[model samples]
Target: MALNETHDEYEQQDLKRNLSNRHLQLIAIGGAIGTGLFMGSGKTISLAGPSIVFIYMIIGCALFLVMRALGELLLSNLQYKSFIDFATDLIGPWAGYFVGWTYWLCWITVGIADLAAINNYLMFFNDGIAFTPVEGAMISIAAILFIMGLNLVTVKLFGEMEFWFAMIKIIAIVVLIAVGIWMVVTGFTNESGAVASFSNIWSHNGMFPQGWGGFLAGFQIAIFAFVGVELVGTTAAETKDPKINLPKAVNSIPIRIIIFYVLALLIVMSVTPWDQINPKVSPFVNLFSQAGIAAAAIIMNLVVLSSVMSSMNSGVFSTSRMLFGLAKEHQAPQALGKLSKASVPANGLYLSSVALLAGAALQYFVPDTVRAFTLATTLSTILFICVWVMIMISYMRYRKLRPELHEQSTFKLPGGVFTCWLVILFFIGTIYIMSLETDTFEALKVSPIWFIILIIGYFGFYKPRLKAVVDSKI
Candidate 1:
């Protein structure tokens, strides 16, 4: 069915059931492999040393629970377009209004930051690449435009690109881990022929090299690395067979977390020694170079570049889809939902690409203007949390409002209402943890202003006195 068809007609098509199993599986891993793992992990390792592994482990558990909860709810009801769609259906239209827009905002800002990071990483090849900022921004802008072109061509092509992009990181990580194990066994440490071995992990202050304080501090970087974990859910609308595919995705997510985060870090710190890690540089690149591996920096740069492109691609794809959904709900301009001959949301994709040019512009005011993007992302996080809570909340309301649906639902939350509250409290606790961090606190301190901007914009543009009507049969 064409997206341009009447709302009644479009809703009748199984938009929720189109995503395939392989697509879902790759997307789950692909989304998780953002530049953070490739570029951001170096900073995290410097802060906590060997203990960063433990920090990742803890985060993985919490995030696992969150994804599991999301899976149970999404599988239970194919009616949900995605979380924002579900939120609107279960909560009020207002919750969907807030979440859909906020998530779009998050992707835009994160896209900018990742693009900036990409430009900086590109400097590895030539220290004198460009300092005028325009040169760097131009490179990312060009990349974004290229990706925008690709995505508008077809959704399946975007999936294919993500699969390849993600594969590069996976291969890099696997090689690193394998090499690390060999280094450990061969006892190859210093150039003097002394073996490094696993002792590096505990050689300092016994794993918690900077004490518990450092371990806790590492969460600042660690949490952000996990930012796009929800990317799989966004693919729900276009997936080929979400029911089987989604569970495959949710189950494999934790395993990838173990390999990419825990094992990879354990290996890096094991051979290099925690104290020797440079915060300003990538530990992965640093390790291979120190070991005299050929073209270490080049390989690492290429891998990180793939990461940047993947993120840009995802940003373009996700933001457009959100706008498409919001348009359906009358929370955004209706034109955004209009599809092209290719069945792709073409306008939304182009608009998001244009939005990222501001990211290129962001290069000018950075270190200062960048704060705006940072706080924007925080509010973005808050907004995502709101949608997640709304998901559980919507489920509760669905149960009460339509008990018959609950009785026949195939994938209900296991513990019923009790688990729902537990997830809610878990969501609240994450916010509390954020409150304790000075930067996150500052970002959140200004979060209300963002909401004000959103609310004002919503009222001015998307507000409608007309009724929201969904056919019962759909």
Candidate 2:
């Protein structure tokens, strides 16, 4: 339980701090944007109309506080490599075990969904290459292996890969926004005779086109878009200067949310009326095609493909690190803790890659890939809520048990303990909203079985082993 004991245990074979500030920054940016925004926003806009803007802002604000709490914790104890490590120390070992395993499951679920999405996107290229679902699954598997190889090389290589991936996303978004603005300014009219104008956002039925129920429905899908926003917290151990770089990355959340989510959606809705936006197609592709761009689908296809790759790459990096942390804590198999000569957790990476291959199989065998993806994404979102709540809970406990650390801390969470509770309440409200819908409710109902299994594993395995370790130390 002592800090020195934990520190000494990892001092000999800890992960190297090869992630510079730039890599940390883009990783944070890339994490905030994902395939969900690119492909799923069409549905959200259809459901919430213009009100989707408020939905994203609300979620973004709440998660910013969550990241602030995480930033404070990581800085308070340099020995704590990731939030999972400190969750085990500050809350209890069981907290570490549950959160670590659930987080791993979260990414695996996300990777599965991404694989399915990648397959769907590949279909857009059928006109040129004649790709099939089987080929899509095969390509997905190859991409997973490629990501695993990049992660195994060195931490810097992983950073560099994320950097370019993030750069591509940023450029695509910037271009989309600029093009939308130009269309509005020039009073351009598309082939359908619908003129581009800022008034399209509310010209259909005033902001709440689908009413309050529709706005509420947006939360279920929109939350999935923000799944990996906390990937920066997982990178704290490898960041060059945790105190400086961590805060810089965390504090920029608001700007990223505004420009990336709010403004981008605002432009999309302004160019194309909410009523005209197809729920099944990406708004980006729809707007580009409407503007008479011949290869709009192909261009958007490539952009969306890059977004999926970025998300899957992050999944590989995060789950591997979570497994590594669990192994170090004796919550997982010991072999997962071993690092290669390059100071990478090679075994853990391989384990995660092997698990991701299941996504390919699911895509190939499942006739209803979309339904399967929906369920997996919903389950992943539920577990992510649990992880974020535990972070807030851990912060509250830190303030009570370690007031001196709070007093001496350089980066204190803005609202302190009060905001932690508010964030928890916000997450609870989101879950309630999810339960009101049929499709999401199914996943919500099934998600508890994961926790039940984790609980049984804790009592059956982890608890006794942890007690013995403590007893031997005494």
Candidate 3:
């Protein structure tokens, strides 16, 4: 097929290059900081004590290498839409099909969790309004439709929304960190006589208060915090100036991790002793409330709500694009490949929104937010790890088959194929750790069902369809 003929296809409609560098940078930051940091950090601190800080650093470092490989691959060929395209070229058609579909589900699951979190957060204001379950579900449906409508108009609007939403999260953390610093400097103490000081980090039971075992346990939840960090790569097709913008966003992962993840938690642990922090409540609100911010809970609730919406927005955008990519390759329904007049994947977006409504349905069915959220997030985490592993494998193949590309590449992955091997092993080890825990283990047990369905679909549907296409061409 000629390039022009390919360009004219429904899936090949050129996505507008309207995402500016600022948009890309904030999107990367937004991906790094998830609702996990806001709500789950207290639990992680209780698990690992002060060592939770180190855990975030280590995970951040490993994922940076993963992003580096992704950046190089996307930049190596501007034509490659996302990691899916490269996986297809270097690994095999099966790799592309699995990764593309899995990546789409990764976002779907994340969106589900985000929607649930958002509804729960909205309950903070319900004391006055007395919001019921039906009302909450209606609000969630409305929120999804609102975001979907925004996405249908322009990709630039999506970038703009993420930028402001991420700014809210960044400001909240910075304010909290500043307040923590002041408290530590003045030797402020809460009602329990626990003085705010850096000593709080190590004074209680030492840094390794939970021992190596607890430190390892922290990885189970902290890993989920980084789930959406690869989101920048998905925006490659719509980004302005891929070579410059993508690398800038990718390389900043470490700095973002240090500031947002490590430093924010460091401040939290410093102001409030790790053992004193309640795992059931947000430490972010705890710190501010103790500091006499009377509206801390209300303020933090709004911040977290925005953060969840930001994540869900990214999920909606990426899942549609993944479906768009899958359809282009004939791995999905051809209709999903069709583009809207605005160049948006409208059908894909609509389908993903329908899938997301399951979150609201889950709220009605499950009712227990904690159990439902944990299962959904754990399943999403497992699927995301699968996608990351495929990226690493594809990178290794890229190096072996296209050594010259690696050689000539200005933004080559450090440690080259060696880093790829190490990252893959790290993910495998993360999975083993997950299996030891009851909640995560249950999700792990259920994960294979998705793959089983995929396998049947591949053999029963995809394989025969490919054969028929080939026969027709002949």
Per-residue lDDT over 83-172 for candidate 3, one digit per residue giving the tens place of the 0 to 100 score = 779999999888998999999999888887776677666665665342456775787788889878878888988999999999999999
Best-performing candidate as measured by lDDT? 2
- Per-residue CA lDDT of model 1 for 160-195, tens digit only, reads 888888888789889889988988898776553446
Query: Lowest-lDDT window of 10 residues in candidate 1?
Result: 465-474
TM-score leaderboard ranking: 3, 2, 1
Better of 1 and 2 by TM-score: 2
The all-Cα superposition gives candidate 3 an RMSD in Å to the true structure of: 2.4
The 10-residue segment with the lowest total lDDT in model 2: 2-11
Tens digits of per-residue lDDT, candidate 2, 1-474, equal 553365355547889899999999999999999877987788889889999999999999998999999999999999988867889989998899988999999899899888877776666666534345577678778888888888899989989999999998898889889999999999888777778899998888899989999999999779999999999999988999889999999999999999999999999988888888987667887788788786765787788888899999899999989988998887877678878999989998999999998888877676355566677788889999999999999999999999999999988999899999889999999999999989899999988899899999999988877776677677
The list of candidate 1 runs beyond 4 A from truth reads 1-19, 128-130, 190-195, 367-383, 399-417, 435-438, 459-461, 465-474
State the C-alpha lDDT per candidate.
Answer: 0.73, 0.87, 0.86
Number of clashes recorded per candidate: 8, 0, 0
